[model samples]
Target: GERAASAAARAEAAAATADARARGDAEVLARLKVSEAEAELRGARERLAELAGVEMQRQALATELSGLKAGQEERDRAHAAELARLGETFSGLAGKALEAAQAKLAENAEAVLARHREAAGQNLEANRNSLAELIAPMRETLVKYETRLGEVEQARSEAYGGLKEQLAAVASGQRLVSEEAAKLVSALRSSGKTSGSWGEQQLRNTLEMAGLREGMDFTLQAHQAGEAGGRRPDAIINLPGGRQLIVDSKCSLNDYLAAVEAPGEAERLAALKRHAAAVRGHARGLAEKAYWNEFGAAADFVVMFIPGENFLSAAMEHDLALLAWAFDQRILLAGPINLLALAKTVALVWRQEKLADEAREIGKLGADLHAAIATMADHLGGVGRNLGQAVGSYNEFVGSLERNVLPKARRFTEMGVERGKKAVAALPAVDAAVRPVAARELLAPPADDAAA
Candidate 1:
């Protein structure tokens, strides 16, 4: 535009010069200035030609610009259409996904409701029955308690009547008895009243005091049907590793009681001898049974428990050879004190066995842990080797590309195609009426779906 304006201004100035020269031509001065005017006119014509060439170059640039603008507008339209298609497809996929989620949620909700309703139905009947029957059992139990109360009242009344009769008898006896007579009565009661029940009761009480649990630590009666036949020991003490120790509660103390009640020193000595013999006989009987061979893990000996300390001591004091003789027959004589000591020793043995088992388990666990660590180290070493191999391969491929492929391929800078060429490099410019996009872009997620 500026060049055109300058050309127009110069042309106007030349026309005005011509008019002035024609008017001033008094036939003398006009003829002399004519050559100079012709020279100026010639210079003006040369400037006009230069301006025209510049205008031609400007027209070519304008044509190229118009073509580029047309192609850009066409590509924009194609991009909009592609984007619209992608948006529609995404909306369809999102709608299907939402429907599937809703369907799954509905199915789970129905299943949960069904389960809740079924549980409610089951409990409702139970609750109704409980409400109806709750008072009936209470009334029945109350009547039964009242009956038992009457029986207890009747028993108390009978006991009071018996006590009144016993008080009268005691008053009579007190008037007749002396102090020496009282002492003799007490002695008679102790010696004659002694029985197996007393001894057994004492044995059970001592066992309870020794802190042994029934069933697990000791079985009440050790009897099992086996090829050796059924031989029931009084009790079996459980030991670790399936081992067992037999305990017999029955010890004969009748002859000892007889000796205590003897009137003369000779009779008492004979009865004491008999008591010692009775104990030896019982020990022999236990040895003859030899319960050890019947059990899979029983010890070589069996324990014969004397229920009373005095009875055991009296027999042992009377016969010096009893303990050694019993030991030779595999019968261990244990009084109350000795039995308690044996229980403590067994408890210690159990603890040692438990520790040994724990050590075995810990050793196995350590071995397993060591194996796992070694396996993990092996895997890590293999991974390091694989990574080194991968790096080597990658460097080799990169060297091949740089040293061989890139140097030989033709590049765009060498072409030097002019503006408004028939094509853009290898592609035709007109073919870009609709620009292409990647398939991945067509599958791009929507904004709302992406957030979800």
Candidate 2:
């Protein structure tokens, strides 16, 4: 029984040992799984942080885009407001101009007709009085002159009839003149092409008046071919420094014409509003063309020439800011008078440039002439020095002959040497000295002073 108990205790101890080993193995496995879980957690945390950064970048981009959109909307609103203001202003001006023009026309027409009628009546009355006085005298003079009086009366009636006809013709001519003027205005507004041609013609006339020569000072219908549809400015004015000034004469006048011919005040106002819009549209178009960019040496602003002062004034009357606005678009709105003045200024600039060129040429000529004179003086100085040297040499030779050779030769002649009857010519020392150069440029400065 003792042995069995001891064996049982040993078996229990072995079982206990196996159980502890199993527990330790389970703990190690659990520790390895926990470490793997911690690593996965750290990796997940990094991925989450990367996702947050991506979301932040997206939000930032969206915010920037929103800001840009808001800015664009603001600009659009301001532009729309400006356009509305311009329209309202133009409408009021158009109405006033139209009313004033109509009233003036009516007043002038009435005054002219009244004056003519008064003059005709006064002349007729005077003639009638003179005829009556003459007839009375004739009737008193002779009854046989009654036949001649009848003939005279018939002739006077025919003359009066002719005079009435002439008055009617004059009235008709005046009406015709007014009609013709309206027709001419209408013709100018008939089509874009016609308006453009007329504007160009007016521009040419103005330029000519400003003394600008075509092809030299200015070119008409200048066409420059390009990849993007080429630019064809109505006129390209040549500036002094090989620069250009573009002028576009294709300004739309249809709306302006409509405003002029509108039957009612409301229609006229609407037409004038349209006219202002058209002008703005044209200015915008010119700005887009950017002629200055195309022509390397072109002026920044292009001239938009309106053929009539009234056309420009009518538009500007309502929209006070029209000129400033156009200028902002790199366009200058020029009427006939304004364009004429600008052209005159350009002509003056050209004249001044020509004078400058002539002055430069004169200066160059003067410099060349001075250089030539300096060179001639230098040669003359050299010749003077050489002459001085020759004079000195001649004097030295004369002294040597007189003191050494000529005296010995004379002694020989005294010693009774038979010689020719002709005696040796007496050599005299030269007294004259070469004249020094008078010019300061020819005279050299002292060597020490020059070094200093």
Candidate 3:
């Protein structure tokens, strides 16, 4: 009986294994079918696109055909009018009995009719031919488009199958990611590191991770010089203007986080006081260090960097007394924006110094230019004086020539004038010989009357 039972159990186990193997094979076959369907769908979609584009072109060609038909009708109407006019004109001319009248009329009418018929017929035939030629190509295009549409339908079905598979896969992936993310969030909260303490730790770690070494631009964990009198600040930042600032990383996580865990008016008040005291204490240290004196005693106040903007906000919200206390100590409280402003102010100071130096140099240059201008003015004045003397000398020389030489030239000119007068008197005798006897007698009588 025991052997029989053992054999039956073995047979049952073997049957179960066979059933599982068959199920796996069935799933594989289903996946293969889906993949094949997808490929067919893709091919169909491509063919459908081709068909749609070609169908659009066919519609445009049909529109063009309508326009061509209208043009043909207009041409036919014009040709008919021309033919009618030619026939009327020929009939009117046929009444003339000239020798070649009939022949001429018939010939002219036939020529005009032939030209009109040829033009009309050629235009009509060309339009008809064009329309006919378009028909076969358009039909072929339509056939191709229909074939492509059929192909697209098949491709669409295949695409739908693949889309289903893809959607399922994406759903599965999203579900897995959501589950993992939830778990990670749960773990993070469970570790107690997700609280405000974590943020403080992160901020401090970030600063430390930047390789903030001691005795460079900053000093972390630096001790005070006093043996047992003063407080040793947490971190000291050396500013550009010989100013030193003390920053206290007062992780208000203990108070703030506690207030969150246990909400009460008293707890909040206590947390506020603790944070203010922490900042105030750091402020007092900053004032004592006289960090403002580091930059040639230029700055009148020192800065107290809270590092955490949230902490600064909480402090300001809780009690403005913290800021007041800092002010009393000549300590300026700064968050990130205020800190950046302070840095910019420092940069502006340096820029102002550079500008001042440049201004001084410019002043010197202006003085040098003034001296050069004076020298140039002196030389220009000398040149002007020399030019004036040259002008004066030229005027005097021209005056001397006009005064001394002009009268002598005038006397010589008068002598030549007198000789010319005598020559003019001889001109009358020469004219007398060429003149008629009566004219000469009149001229001699006129000379006596002229003298009188």
The regions of model 3 sitting more than 4 angstroms off are: 1-269, 292-298, 345-364, 386-452
Model 1 over residues 245-301: C-alpha lDDT tens digits?
Answer: 888865575578778889999998898899888888889988988889776677889
Q: Extract clashing residue pairs from model 1.
A: none
- Candidate 2: pairs in clash: 89-318
Ranked by TM-score from best down, the candidates are 2, 1, 3
Q: Provide backbone clash counts, one per model.
A: 0, 1, 7
Question: Can you give the lDDT of residue 281 in candidate 2?
Answer: 79
Regions more than 4 Å wrong, model 2: 1-183, 415-418, 421-423, 446-451
Candidate 2 lDDT, tens digit per residue, 1-452? 54355445545544554564477654333333333334333433444554456556556655665665566557556755664565567757786775565567557755765665576566556655655554554344344234434544564466477778999999999999999878877786676677778778998999999999998999998888766779888899999888999998755778888888899999998888788777777888888888888788889899998888887887887678889999998899999899999999999999999999999999999999999998998898888889888998888888888889887888888999987889787666678866666767777888997999
User: Quick one: ranking by lDDT, best first?
Assistant: 2, 1, 3
Q: Which candidate number has the best lDDT?
A: 2
Evaluate all candidate structures by whole-model CA lDDT and list the values in order: 0.68, 0.75, 0.57
Better of 1 and 2 by TM-score: 2
- Candidate 1 regions with alpha-carbon error over 4 angstroms: 1-212, 226-229, 257-271, 408-410, 416-452
lDDT (Cα, tens digit) per residue for candidate 3, span 114-182: 775576567557655655564555465456546645554655566577879999999999999999867
